[model samples]
Target: MWSGAAHVVDAMEKWPSSQEPTQTAYGLAHGTDLTFFEHLAGNETKAKHFSDSMTFMQSAPELRHDFVHEYDWSRHARGTVVDVGGSKGAIALKLAENYPNMKIIVQDRAEIITHGPRYANTNIEFQAHDLFTPQPVKGADVYFLRWILHDWPAR
Candidate 1:
């Protein structure tokens, strides 16, 4: 996180004269063309650390409570909710625990999906999906994209 923040600092320093104001911080930090996840993907340790960090963040009670109360999930009680990029299905599990009638599908990358069955609740299904491609599960009630967009450079 600190490294990413430092990258933001570096990116800001270069931002003033640049044509693209929202250039990626990771690109500036590493002086490379690869994005942050692309770099992490090539490094096993960093990828594991990143996954662990996300798990830690999702475990926070305040974050879970905010997610639960902020949305009107009752409207989709009988519908399917596809949580796109939902790593480990933490939010989906919480929603399943709260609403028995709703079916939640947590979709993430193949690496994450391999371990999904072990961690995910029985009520919450896990699927391997790349968010950049078209959504496989069609006509779902909600396609939740929680904390996913910030990874890319702003357009």
Candidate 2:
């Protein structure tokens, strides 16, 4: 316990000492002090780390069944679809392969898109873009945003 003149402790010491905690501090400590969404939004390194962590998590069998079967690419013809936040061009490359006649634009953050070894296929094009702002590409028959919206909130 901290000795003081009956709740008249100095302004600096009125709060609990940082090293340990009183009951109130202990109770509050159990709750999260930081907003998880805000933290993830601001921390680019954390976002990239998380994205990379999920890199190998995609399985071919799963992609074939879940993604390929889920959509009918034949509906759209003779145009490009921009893949927003299309990291490493995985989905874009797959779409390009499936829809050989259609061009695929894989857009992602400058940090992710600027590095070496982007997609080599002529059908796929890579551009540095930030999704927080308005999209750059236009007039596409389709705009793909696979697994990207949830990264930020709906609002």
* lDDT scores in order: 0.75, 0.60
- Residues 1-155 of candidate 1: C-alpha lDDT, one tens digit per residue: 45657677667776654444236576666666666666766766666677667777877766545677788999998899999988877788778878888989889877766654454335688888888798899999999998898665455
Error of 2 at 87 (Å): 0.9
Question: Model 1 lDDT vs. the true structure?
Answer: 0.75
Candidate 2: residue pairs that collide: none
Error of 1 at 125 (Å): 1.7
Question: How well is each residue in 1-155 modelled by candidate 2, as lDDT tens digits?
Answer: 02222333432354544322222222233332333323334557755654564454454456433565588877764687888877767677667777788888888766566551365555888898877788778788888887776544344
Candidate 2: residue 24 Cα off by (Å): 22
Give the candidate number with the greatest TM-score.
Answer: 1
Decoy 2 TM-score against native:
0.62
Candidate 1: residue 126 Cα off by (Å): 1.6
